[model samples]
Target: MLSSSMRHTRPRQRLINPFARATARPGAASSSHPCPMAGRGAATAAAAWRPVSVLDDWVAREARPISLRQLMVFGRSLTESRLISSANYVRTELPSRIAHRLRDMQQLPYVVVTNPHINDVYNLYYKAFDTFRKIKEVKTLEDNDRLCEIISENLKGHLTVIPKLAMGILECRGLMNPQDLDKFMNTILRSRISRRVIAEQHLSLTETYHSPHFSPGAKLSESDFIGEVFIRCQARDVIDRCARAVTALARSTNGPDAQVPAVHVDGHLSASFPYILSHLEYIIGELLRNSVQAVIDRQAKLREKAVAAAAAGSTTSTTLNAALNQPPPPIEVTICEAQEHVIIRISDRGGGIPRDELPYLWSFSKGPKSANRLENLGQVPRMAATMQELHIDELARADLKAPSYPTPPPPTPSPLQQPPSAATPHTPSQQNSLSSLTSRPPNLRLGMGLPLSRVYAEYWAGSLHVHSLEGYGVDAFLQISRLGNKNEQLTTRASMDAV
Candidate 1:
């Protein structure tokens, strides 16, 4: 299959968000059932079944910083419990849990905001809350599919708010009480993580819900139980696509960047494992975007200093010559594989994240990327997207077959359909149809990418780590576990003591 990166380079009009497409019409050639298929087939009516133990645990853990470790455990425990039961069972259990989450998120309005960025955080909580409420109403496979559609339509807008919200929380920390702030952060973080897991499990169950084996009389196998929650993913190609997307952003025509920075890709890259392609695509693009932004911004700073030196007549010829002669180091990615895991290391020497910033690096409440200057923060991501579109248009116009022979782009990878390989380019009809389903390009304003990527990695028992030296560079480590047992039943890890 073609890497998702190649798909983003195609000359196509922008869509609201990728994954917003549904097979406009179900195919006539296939005979299949629809919605709520396979898992344990049983149903229980929704009830106000709030467990006292859960409430007690919450009350007991008051007025103190909540460890991230505890949230992961709680989130995973909930997911495991849901996955063991049927779609109907999980749906019946949703109301009380969602009610608790809604109460916590409802408190976001009380938090004070010192800047528009902080307001972004205040608003994203509302976004999450509304999404949670809608999710609670999903009691059937059809409802689950509809919920996924709704999320796709809203994902880009919500994502655009993440970086700003993350920045805002930190900036407004002074205005909020210490205990309130910690509880707020903990509550929201745990809620997001839990909702994410539940959403995923529902999607999985809905995928297998219609098969004959899902009927009450027929026994379901492990494969029928979980369906394609995980699959063999082509990892190297996804990274390649992300790299090209980064390049397109660098050379984007509609952005403020007047000069392009050099980009290079090297090392062994071809590898595959059982995984979710979209999650990997999202994680990689976000990380690479951070690297590209740092490199370009640093390069711009050096240029400004050089021009200033020349204007002031203060530069010794040797210093100017040396500066002009040396090229910036290329951002590097190294991928290593093992029987059980894939390790990807992305390194950049474009100056490290500041020391003071390190303390807040992974926190959603950390300061915004533009806290010192928020005026242009929102415009930054839009500009990058615009720049990418312009670049693709230029490429199309410059092609030899400008009229009837524009070079075709790669096909979008789809979960419900087969995707053509990169070597055999997708036809224009297909491209136009599936363009919206393509993986999204890198976002420049997304400060939450690192933390979010970790979520994606951890969802599959993988990990993401950031190691940086103040003046030198940052190295991000991504370790993804190999294929899970194809026929294995869904269950929580035997030992979830800590990450």
Candidate 2:
């Protein structure tokens, strides 16, 4: 059917198997037909089914940039037409972003690309990109409705992206340098954040548009929420909620008698701004959990030393009793509302981070040298599926549940009934048994906590900093921009491999 010139033209690289296989020759199935030649043809067909280069067409397409301020303005008075426009924007933007990541993966060294975890992630991204790029134009409410369904399904399908990416990087750590790995990870995570921001923003707007209470033309007040962005978000309220949730979690995991420290929140108690509540919860919750755990561990060490001294006859009963009864120092949180930002300081008196671990504190490519990091990495697939799933309330939904502790035995009826000394308080057996390295509870340690928190904070033009006092404690500073006018920082690096 082809013209002479067309038939003689050089063939384009067959990237993606778009066409079905050619049918076997007539009577090829009979005994007379050569089986080895047919098998060879099929093998060649399978080997040539490459699809990596096809993503370039989509990657060449540009993504429409979006900002938080724009989100708030558009969501303030969402209408049906606006909702449809948002849906289309998300549909087109997501594919471009997905394609970009796919290209980044394709450009990796063949060895790294072939890693099982990375290959699985590549397939998922390709599937999502293919499905999204196939959607028809949205011109009606019905069309938008179908697009929403598709978006939801895709979002659900990509839930394991974070863990899969982490595992892949860990496996390929030796194949790439630290700087290159960090850049690749930052690009992927930031791009993901941008995509989710638009996708979720549109979904929320659609929900608000259909709500009975929504009045498109009604004048809105500063107290109202425009989709997921709150016009006046209470900073302290979210911190308190996350603190309470973390406190409850600590007790349940450490045992009934665990000495969880109190978080003392002060300054600018009523400061409010336009922000996303879920984001605030995650950042604050992670920081607080780290602080509380540090304080608890510090106190436990002091108690153990006191008990050891008492056994060795090194101190008087008064001093020993004081040490035994001492509670964990309170964690202090100060909130400051500036003209254009909200700055929070979380100060804790837990023994500071080990000096050796400080350099890699915020580096995801190389975690601190500890067995706990590896254990936590192993649980990522079961522990975390999505950012929202990191919230305290969602902890129960994870498959790796915390172990239960038996009730502590009642005080000894008589001194003889107990061992040589009855004065020592019941040792925190459950807490001590759950070593950071061997514990089964995934919440206790996620190796990527500090790094992920930093990414989330920086995603919106904000920042997170940590200062450790070596043997004293740690102070964390979090800056949030209330203006929300900065564009997202997404990288467009083609390849990170060294020449």
Candidate 3:
């Protein structure tokens, strides 16, 4: 059992948002007491630019009035607050290079951070936060419904920006000191914990708010208490959509009508309870894509051998063509539910991730092997979007609180874009893990898939892990916690001290 202190979650109605963070701009008004390390934070705070406010034009559409700017400020302010704090996160544990990077982040003027990806993430956050802050006013079902609409809109916006944000962060990774990698990793971990908390709170609140039978300040029914998450995820339907996405992607890469091996689930498709669908779609899509690619490559090789045999007079031409046309083995998906968790296993026979690459399966850094390619993380998402084309708008639809966000753009090759040859191609399981569903082939792969997926998987009380059999295949296990009311965020030092 967790301590009472651990169970303390930020109030859902109106979060105690720091006024200073209400705008991504640091010079904004103050709310919460000053930081404990005010002496250390003063310069960074002073140098921080005031957060920008969007032009608010209240427009009523479909009987719902949307305060575009307030929502925008809400999400961005939350992000800015976290990031501003993260800029100095675990200062004592970091070395100078990373520490400097963290502090420098606080000092970055809004104008200097010109990337659309960076800007969009903050924008979405501010919007979401603004909506979240208004939950207390949801005494009536109509108000709750309005709140849901705004929240969904912000989530859609999140899809448009997250990959870009991840890419932007990685662009400067090379400047990180080797010895301080752990420290940098810690910073990301904290950020992930914060994101998870924010997702669960708002998403769960959405479930309650959108329900026709829902009531404010009433005891939540046990049956409906998964808190708006991990509920009624149609595994069969999800598989169908993902399979279509995979097939379409495969055909486009190999041929307009190329017959890639289909994905085969080991059991009857089941509906999952309390799971985020978009994130699942991404995970499953990536696994199937790689599996299909491997089967296709294997079939091609078999055809090559058969053709050579035919020339050698050992096999008939007709038999060789028949052998060449046989469908590759289907990738198997296994879904199992326990009392407290939902587990999905995706198995593929793509000649398993190369043995040497196994250890780094979870890493995002461009190690020594691809040093000569000279591409940074910012370009990987664009490349992945270009080749495999996993971006789909349907995934952003708000059913179970709009899972994660939308995917990267379609795979469009351009002279400006560089393929992920800088590093070894990641597998299907990892390909769609966090970026685009596109993974490795003749040369393409989702460059940031595995690490990103891990973030999502671990965001809740869940896990994503890989088990590989070299020269045979790989199985990725994704676990989603079925329990509810987890700690919304990590504990702060101040909280711990009080405890």
Which candidate leads the pack in TM-score? 2
Q: Write the per-residue lDDT of candidate 2 for residues 203-316, one digit (tens) a residue.
A: 666655665555765545566555556567677866775676567667766765888899899999988877655566667878998999888889989988988998899988
* Higher-lDDT candidate of 1 and 3: 1
TM-scores for candidates 1 onward, in order: 0.54, 0.79, 0.53
Model 1 clash tally?
8
What TM-score would candidate 2 get against the native? 0.79
Give candidate 3's whole-model lDDT. 0.43
TM-score, predicted candidate 1 vs. hidden true structure: 0.54
Listed per candidate, the RMSD to the true structure in angstroms reads 17.3, 13.9, 15.4
Look at candidate 1 and give me any clashing residue pairs.
5-241, 36-209, 37-209, 37-210, 38-208, 38-209, 167-367, 167-368
Report every candidate's CA lDDT. 0.44, 0.64, 0.43
Tell me, by lDDT, which candidate is best.
2
TM-score of model number 3: 0.53
Give the Å error, residue 314, model 3. Answer: 7.4
Show the colliding residue pairs in model 2. Answer: 16-50
lDDT of predicted model 1: 0.44
- lDDT score, residue 166, model 1? 47
